[model samples]
Target: MTNFSGEVAALAAACLWAVASIVYGKLGARIPPLQLNLIKGIIAIAFFVFTILVTGELFPSITILPMCLILLSGVIGISLGDTAFFTTINTLGPRRALLMQTLTSPISAILGLIFLQEKLNTLAGCGILLTILGVAWVVSERTTDIGHISTAEFRRGIVFGLLTAAAGAVGAVLSRSAIANTQISPLWAALLRLSAGILILLVWASFRQQSTFRLSSLRNSKVIAGTLFAAFCGTYLGIWLQQTAIKFTSVGIASTLLQTSPIFVIPFAIWMGEKVSIRAILGVVISIAGIALLFYL
Candidate 1:
């Protein structure tokens, strides 16, 4: 078997997630983000369990400290960060929301330094910046009139976006802290984090007097198919690749590569019959250049 680098894994995860996002964009019109998150999470967990059983992999005995850290990472990253991102998308629209998403790379870099004492060299740091710049440029091409939103509402959306970025960064940093130098399998780590996130969402739903067990959407065959595909691409395989990337690379590099999802989104968008603009094409070129620099320069 050829040994693939962490960079390859991260890039693949980004591509899968980009496709998942395109699918979810159509479904988001009908389903609430929280409920969708829980549903997909449950489905993904089922697949994860099946993989574990088929592989005959025994669960590792993890200590409380690492377990707690990993669980917290999921709660912060998936539970809170994803929810906040959904809210931002609703408030600010996907374009602005995607612009805000670029913040995660730098925030992860900073958090990685503070928590893991990980430092990037000059070229790597430049690559991160160039990647972010490319993604931001591609995503900020919307002209939606936000005049209807009050000043306070606009500010609230900005705050939510910032929180989403910070939570995601902190969560990944925590995962690094918990699993660094450990014998934990990336698949198992992903399972634990996903379970933690789903548990947290269930608890929050209960507290809100909402039912997390609603299955009306499952009745529709198309919806079922879309959900399963999203779960497989976005949560199941996407997360496993994310864990593998984190295990083999610095969090900064992993995060910068992962944020290239926007670049991948461009090709998918064109496939979906959306018109591709010159600026978006330029952004893709810039992002590819940055990735090349990160790996080769």
Candidate 2:
């Protein structure tokens, strides 16, 4: 149990990320993807400061190497990874894109084992297999006439989501690596990541020639609601819980549980009046199995 502290923190991070997914998911329903990402980061930045003030342990001594690592993780995970995911959700719907979590745990494990030289024994391998199989079960559509989405389009969305998950896994490992080397403070590291994510999007918006970002959009009621939730979950709560978990546990376990965003998204999707399918059910089951194996196996 003592050694499980890290695992416990990972679980907490997963739950928080799950909630953030819900927040951003709903926000996407109402707004453009760029606006959603932009405001989400802005809101998160505010709460991050609040968190620093509230927690006395917020200020850690800063250094260069760890800061660079965490910032890179942010670029990979928050910027590129999330951009792919949101696009997938828009293209494939949350039910389908979320199912991609099934692959993330195994990918993270393999990456960590390769790059970080973390252990990946038989049980871990078995856990990875079961989890993937379960996720496949959850999202596998049976009907030939499932309406609208052609097979090609469906596959495209899955591919995008998987890419997002893969990149995200790499980011998680990198963040963990930085934390392991106590050369930099986690707060500054997190700040770098958040700021970097925001900047990346800033450049993207400029590149795409998006019209002036509107204060009116920011003032929208739903955007405000979503922003608050985003701040709480993604910026303050999510990162805080994530660092705590990673600092305490293996990067593999932390990624495993955080990928459970799909699991939480399922019920939330239903509650939001989206149609639930048998395929989606199977995907959730697979993801849960994967998570269980990640911990218990």
Candidate 3:
């Protein structure tokens, strides 16, 4: 169990992110993408700080370079990547946006090979490929819920989705480099990343003369609750798990497992009264086979 802890963490993170995405889809209707990113960052930062304090984990002494890498990872991944993802969600709808996210696995794998010199064995490589294939297949299925999208919107979504995938890949590799051989706790890493991301987001919001703290849409209790829940699950815990995955596993494996959120979303969709097709079911089976290979191989 301990040997595969990273893989497990990555899978768990995907599940939490799946839940968060569902809540975030509703919240996106009421809030702008950047502001939504900022709001969740603030909420998650509070949780990170509280957890660090309660655990009595003092900030570890680290050299400047790794610290800088982590901070940059936060800005790129959380600030830019998340904003692009939210925009993708709005423009393309959650299904297609998630399909776009499937690109992250291969992108991160290539980045890992080039920058980090990390390589996976043949079987592990096959597992990653199968997992990505399943996720892509599942998310590409059309549903009645998705309304009509114009050509311009579709094109815009594709661009942002690609951007999101690139940013996420870069960020993950940077993060993996920072903590792969270090004494940095995943909790602390998550905190630093969230802090840097939120800071940048706040500056960007101010530069645009946008309200930095005005959350009028959150006036509704349900919205507030959902936002808080999503922040806690997705931003706080999910990121910690992600960092843990990067720390313990190869970047390619970690990234591929993280991209399994779409597979996890299947049950959530069913519960929400959305219809699942035979193709989607087949995709899930393939993904599960991939996950099994990853686990037992």
The lDDT for every candidate, in the order shown, is: 0.77, 0.70, 0.82
Q: Which ten residues in a row have the lowest lDDT in candidate 2?
A: 138-147
Scored by lDDT, model 3 comes in at 0.82
Which residue pairs show backbone clashes in model 2? 6-248, 6-249, 134-286, 135-286, 138-279, 138-282, 138-283
Off by over 4 Å in 3: 1-3, 112-142, 209-214, 281-297
For each candidate, C-alpha RMSD in Å?
3.6, 3.4, 3.2
Off by over 4 Å in 1: 89-99, 112-140, 144-159, 209-214, 250-252, 281-297
Worst 10 residues of 1 by lDDT: 138-147
Model 2 misplaced regions, further than 4 Å? 1-8, 54-59, 113-119, 142-147, 150-152, 183-188, 212-216, 274-279, 291-297
Task: Find the 10 residues in a row with the least total lDDT in model 3.
Answer: 288-297
Question: Taking the tens digit of each residue's C-alpha lDDT, what string does model 1 give over 1-297?
Answer: 755578798999988877787777666666777888888889999999999999998988789899999999999999898778777766665444544666676666666677679776788678667856875676555433345676787778778888887888788878888887788889999999999999999888888865655577668888889989988998999999999998988654676677777677766666766676788678766755565455444
TM-score, one value per model: 0.82, 0.82, 0.86
Residue 271, model 1: lDDT of: 73
Better of 1 and 3 by lDDT: 3
Estimate, for each residue in 232-297, the C-alpha lDDT of model 3 and write its tens digit: 998999999999998888765776688788778878878988776878778866765665554345
Angstrom error at residue 154, model 3: 2.1
